[model samples]
Target chain A: MVKKFMALLRMKYIEMFAYQWATLAWSTGAMVQPIITMMVWINIYETEMESFILYFSTLILVERLTAAWDVWDLDRDIREGSFSNYILRPIHPIHWAIAENIIYKGLFLVVLVPAWLVSSFFLPSLQLHLNGWEWMLFISALLLGGGIRFMFSYSCGLLGFWINKVTAVYAMFEGISLFFSGRIAPFSLLPPIMQDISLYLPFRYMIGFPIEVITGSVKGADLGYGFLGAFIWVLIFMGILGFLWHAGLKKNQAVGG
Target chain B: MSIVVDHLNKQFKVHVRQAGWLDAFRSIFKREYQIVEAVNNLSFTIQSGEIVGFLGPNGAGKTTAMKMLAGLLHPTSGAITVEGFIPQEQKAEYKKMMSLVMGQKSQLIWDIPPMETFLVNKAIYEIDDNSFNKTLDELVALLELEPLLNKPTRSLSLGQRMKCELAAALLHRPKVLFLDEPTIGLDVDTQEKVRRFIANYNREHKTTILLTSHYMGDVTALCKRVIIINHGKLLYDGDLDVLTEKLTPYKLLEVHLPTLPNQSWETYGEVDSIEEGKVTLRIPRERIREVSARLLQEFPVHDLNIQDPPMEEVITLAFQEKSHG
Candidate 1:
């Protein structure tokens, strides 16, 4: 099992390096969103004499670091007939996809760490100082967010079993994530009650919860609740993902074999 | 030491359809199902290292049978064992022992060199570096894949890519090779080259090859025994030469006579066609010597030749007979 894991890691790095230029383009796209957010928030702070602007700019920093990867993998695999090749292999192709996500997430951190440095340097308002308990809560939220995001997107991919054209579904998923994940604006900035409503949905837990903790939007009791909410949603999505996997395999036709 | 498929049966739960939009919508709500008996009560056994050709017309269940043997598709009701192990178990050891290649589908990664695909297969098969290199060197030399190895799969011609595909499938040096129309769509020259490669590979590795091909030459060149099926039923299973003898009992006798014979040609054999003063007759295999002697004495024959009916005729006749019965 260790050999398989190590081999998978090696393969993931090799594949990522081969498509390094594509990765660069992707990271650049991700970077542009945060830069645009920072500019807009800085302008908004020009008028409002409040600390909310500090949390808003910090929102940009957190969103830049935590990016979701699902639509691209699912949409491309559906478009190319290459998915057949994946299904034919003895090993479950999901293992490779998981390894690739791990590699991409690790690589994203490289750009993310430097981006954090630059943001804090230029805009001191983007940095948040927290106690040890706060840090623990924030990391836990992020880990739970990863699980929620992976399982939800995987369940979306299994829609391939029923629909031949799944790009529309993926497009909708991406569009919703961009808004609900707080990439457009901080979850707090949505509407008066929208923040409470967002907490009930998994999308907020996937991206918004972690970002909220990092930007110090969550107070002592709220931070604990956010972590708990993320964990519960992760369980829900995990169940959904497991069900979709078994159902998808049963419905598999093995076309053109 | 042997592979056996006992009472093999396969049924596909095909969705039934009516041709209009309403039916299509109704099918979404309630689907009609039909069971297609792809292979029914089929049984065959093959010993180790014996090359058997599976011959059948389209939809004759050859592929369904091959899929069963490869453990890709489950049998509806049957038992299949290869070397004392059930195939559908699909253990890593069982997968390591066999390889499958389909002519219609390719395993090579397009836009990348074949070597990349080879490396991927190496990783999947868990082939050690030393064994991988040795086996790859042997396949490269045998398949003449050296030139095609580095070129992107999309750039290589069909024949070249097929050679690489074969090599890729065999990189693990599988003991049983399920080659489904491996030489399809190749030029005659390339087909012969691939046929020779399969033959040589089998000889060197002592691999058990169960091959399916539309080209009879592919069957004759590499396999001495054939299992002929028509409409999912085995029509004949034995020596290829014996099938020809049993199905077609007559030889085609073409006589290029010096001049037209005024006498009736019934004494020689059944007259099939007489054109341009050349007479072609079909004579029973047993009467060939005597009939030729009598024909020579009676007619001013310039050239007389006797040939067995083409194997294509025998195969067609086998299917025709099965189709009726």
Candidate 2:
């Protein structure tokens, strides 16, 4: 399995290079919304520019790290029947998607980490101050966040077996996630009720909770609860993914085969 | 038997919608569905190392059956066991032992060279480096893929991409290969090359191959046995020669004569066509010898020949019989 995963990672890396422009465009373009949101908040608050800058920059990094395109891929492949190529292979099809995620996110880190360091040298707000344990906890939250988002997108993609317009459904979910996952604002700035609601929902864990961890807004029992909520959501999404995979295979018409 | 399909069946629930916006909107609220029986109670067995042609016309459930055999779709009912493994179960060992190639649906990564796809399969199938190298070398030589290996799949011609697709699918050395229209849309020369490669590969590897093709030449060249189906029903399954002989129990007699006959030739046999001094007759197989002799004696025959009906004609008759029955 490890050998196969490495091979898949290598293949996906090469594929990324083949579409270098698209990869660059996507990885860079995704930052625009958060950066724009950051500017708006900075102007509106007038005094909290540094914190707002830190918040949105970290959001950009965390969002890119957790981004998943499997829904779009699955929607097209399953509908067009090219997905059967993966299905018929000895390895499970999900491994390919997972490998792709690892490679793309690894690339994002490689590009964004240096960019963040350089920006921090210019703008001190971009610099993070945290102890070793805090850094470890933040990294754990980021990985968990990525896992949640991947499972959610992949599960939504599996819906393509039953529905022709699965991407639209996923788009609706993504729009909801925008507000709930703290992309537009920090989780701490949300209205009290919304913050309470975000605690129980998985979307918050996908992007918001990780940002909260790094921003130092989630500490003490809230930090414990954040990890607990994130872990629970991971299990829930993993369960959903498992059920969807098995059911989707049975539902699969293997269209165009 | 390398493959055994016992009463295998697959049915799809397809939405039925009419044209126009109102109907589409109504369908969104209240959709109707019809059950499409893509494959129904199909039972057939193929022995190990046998290359059997799966013959069918458009929408004849050929691809559906192949997909079921390849474990790409779940059968609505019944069962399919390929190499002692139930295909729908999709066990890893079962998958390791079989491969499927759909000419219309490519497995090759479009933007990358096919070698990358081969390497990916090597890992997915856990093929040792030695075996992977050996098999790839053999396939590359046989398919003449030395130059094409490094080119992007999208840049290569359809024939070249198909050769790469074949090579990629075979890198695992599967024991049973399910080919759905493997040579579709290729030129005659490329089709012949694919056919020869399939035949030679089957011969060398003793792999069980179940192939479906619209082109009769593919079947005639590579498969002595064929299984014919239509409307998800098995119409015929046996030797290709036997099916032809059974469907068309007559031989075509062509006579090259110095002059045309004046009287009706109905007394001898059914006149299929006549042009100038050349006459063609459909004579019963039992009487072909007698008819040929009489034609030679009376018709000023220069040369005469007897031949079975073409495979296309025989297969058409088989389908017609099923439909008309």
Top-lDDT structure, candidate number: 2
lDDT of each: 0.77, 0.92
Number of the predicted model whose DockQ against the real structure is largest: 2
lDDT of 1 by residue, B1-325 (tens): 5679899988878889999999999999998999888888889999899999999998899988887787666677989988776766656678777888988778886656788788877888888999999999988887888888888788898899889989988988888889989998899999999999999988998999999999988988998999988666788889998988888999999999867867788878999889887999999999999999988887778998898787778889988988888
Whole-structure CA lDDT of model 1: 0.77
Instruction: Give the range of the ten consecutive residues with the poorest summed lDDT in model 2 chain A.
Output: A187-196
lDDT of 2 by residue, A54-123 (tens): 8999999999999999999999999898998888888889999999999999999999999999999999
Docking class of 2: high
In model 1, residue pairs whose N, Cα or C atoms come closer than 3 Å (at least 3 residues apart or on different chains), thus clashing, are none
Off by over 4 Å in 2: B257-267, B275-277, B298-303
- Please identify model 1 stretches exceeding 4 Å from their true place: A1-25, A30-84, A106-144, A159-163, A166-179, A190-201, A219-221, A228-250, B16-33, B253-281, B292-308
